[model samples]
Target: MMVEIAIFFLLIFMIIGMLFVLEIENLLSAVVMMGAIGFGLSVIFLLLGAPDLAIVQIAVEVISVVILIRATIHRDIKERADESLSNISSIPLLVCIFFFFLMIYPALRLLPTFGEPVFLNFYSSSVYYLRDGFHLTGAPNIVSAIILDFRAYDTLGEAIVLFTSVIGALSILRYRNRKKEHNAS
Candidate 1:
């Protein structure tokens, strides 16, 4: 019950944070709100009994926020002469958001109640992993064994993807800085 309540509040905070991020005119404040939302998600992950996921979520969130802050720190927000156009553009986004929730409402209702086991019956592969993962992979932790040994290639691929994304962000930031300097000169 406590976990459910905590999750509920965290979800609420995350939703509100996202709205703030979207609506706030200040870029830095928006980044900070995004960080708050990310941390809220990490907390929810921890409360749900997935500490590993929580750790990863927090790490990714921290890195992403750092990058975003760096990217926005030196920039100034330009005022638009046509504010009405901006407001008009947002109408479609609002409509899309409403329709998205409408589409997913039924799926959300089908989900099991909070704190209930998602799978009433475990799969054979899951049983095998639990029974033999440590022995086969020689890892003391079953989760470690499964991720690092059994799914080694998948793990490597994910790591590569993360690395690529970070590099891409950094390069883009550097390129933007260079372009700004060139234009200023």
Candidate 2:
């Protein structure tokens, strides 16, 4: 119950952060709010027992926020937002958003209740893994059996992707530093 309440509050925080990002006039402030929203989502993912997703979200959020802030830091973004144009565009955007919710409302209602098994009505391999992974793989831990035995290749792929991302980010940062040093000399 406490975990659910915390998730609910984090959801509310994320929504408010999103609204702030949309409405704030300052580019840097908007980027900060975006980071807050992303961090809130990571927290919610953690609370929901998906630490892998939470870690990925944190990494993506950090990199994107850094890039956005670097791009916008020297720009005069406030002067770029024309008030009259925004006023005119907001009406149609709101209308479109309303219609979008109307279209998706029925599908939302069809979703399973919170904390319920989403694949209960269908056959899912996850059910087999959860039930018999340890027995079939002769592993003491269910997670170990699932990852080491059943999904070894998938896990290897994910590790490779993460390694590539880290190397790419580091290269970009190093390039920026080298450019700065060259300019100084």
Candidate 3:
């Protein structure tokens, strides 16, 4: 019961942090708020018995903050007054928020209550994996077996995507450097 209440408060804090990030006019402040949101999410993950996910969330958040700082260090940190949405523009924003809640309401209703058993009908599948996963996949850990053996292709695709993004960023930086050199010469 106390754990659920803690998780609920953490979630509320995360939501508030996200809202502050979106509404803040200063880019650096927004980035800091984003870090706060990430930290809250990591705590929530820990509360949910997902230590691995919590660790990954913290690592990713730190790397993300570093990257964002490097990327925006040379850019304007303050939002321009002209970029702010006028009162008339808020009508569409409110409409979009309404539709977003409308779409999410049903999905939210389908979620089991906190601390309740989930996927009760899938117990057999879980048991089979727990009992035979090592023999079938030669992986010592059940989570490793499921991710590396059962979902190898999906994991490989995600790795490929990350690799491609890194390559793309390198290429863009290289091209920019060459352009700067040419202009300097």
Pairs of residues at least 3 apart in sequence or in different chains that clash in candidate 1 = none
Q: Rank by TM-score, descending?
A: 3, 1, 2
Q: Tens digit of lDDT per residue, candidate 1, span 106-144?
A: 999999876667553566666787888877988877778
Candidate 1 similarity to native, TM-score: 0.76
Task: Tell me how far the alpha carbon of residue 99 in candidate 1 is from the true structure, in angstroms, after superposition.
Answer: 6.4
Taking all chains together, each candidate's TM-score versus the true structure is: 0.76, 0.67, 0.80
Per-residue lDDT of 47 in model 3: 88
Give residue 166's error in model 2 in angstroms. 8.4
What's the C-alpha lDDT at position 116 in model 2? 86
- Per-candidate Cα lDDT values, in order, are 0.85, 0.86, 0.85
Candidate 3 vs. truth: CA RMSD?
A: 3.1
Error of 1 at 60 (Å): 1.3
Checking candidate 3 for backbone clashes, the offending pairs are none
Model 1 residue 167 CA deviation in Å:
4.5
